[model samples]
Target: MTLDPKEPVLRVVPGPTDINANGHIFGGWVLSQMDIAAGIVASRRANGSVATVAIDTMEFLAPIHLRDVISVYAQVERVGRTSMGIRIEVVASRDRGREEVKVTSGLFTFVAIDADAKPRPVDAPE
Candidate 1:
């Protein structure tokens, strides 16, 4: 099941290179997708540059298979002075969208940055 009902931040399809020798998609590939989705949400919220600070938590619930369409969902869970906690979830749609399974969930921290790559307030004006 998808973690959220709203639209996904990113949808991606895995290629042959993404598959592992075990015939399942690589966990690192799924993690990259989650990070990308979280970065997108964090950047939009910060309204400027942002950098990933940390991954607070992560859980891999199901194995992703080849030909599964990955839907990454992310949102701002909390906003700090210079950082935001992004909640990210990944769902894999299989069998041509007939079945969907929650593949992974994670929480990431992102800090807003200025031109110098220093921390900046999240509410800073445009």
Candidate 2:
């Protein structure tokens, strides 16, 4: 899937509270951002609420430093009757935006749910 930096699903800077003892951002924090971004994309496609069912794969390529701007990009890679597999990529821009690094990436699965919270068809008419 093509990820456009010009159109990130979410973008924000890491805070001091989000840092680890190693002077890098916490993995959990990054994962949370990925999930939020993936949820937005999945919900838009589903035209309703979607829950994260699984993280099929994840990779931590580099550490994210404080003061770096984190940009998350996500796209629906595949969709089933009720579930969608979204591919998420995170990039960190540092050195006043001169340098960009791919820090984390993962494939997360989300299932659309109805008002009663039961799984619903993703293609159902809204």
- Which candidate wins on lDDT? 2
**Candidate 2 local lDDT, residue 79:** 99
lDDT of 1 at 33: 91
Candidate 2 lDDT over residue span 3-122, tens digit each: 454589999999999999999999999999999999999998898899999999999999999999999999999999999999999999999999999999999999999988899999
Error of 2 at 113 (Å): 0.2
Q: Given candidate 1, what's the lDDT at residue 119?
A: 95
Count of clashing residue pairs in every prediction: 0, 0
Q: lDDT values of the candidates?
A: 0.91, 0.93
Give the Cα-based TM-score of candidate 1 against the true structure: 0.94
Model 1: lDDT of residue 18: 92
Query: What's model 2's overall lDDT?
Result: 0.93
- Evaluate residue 63 in candidate 2 and report its C-alpha lDDT on the 0 to 100 scale: 97
In model 2, what are the clashing residue pairs, if there are any? none
Best by TM-score: 2
TM-score of 2: 0.94
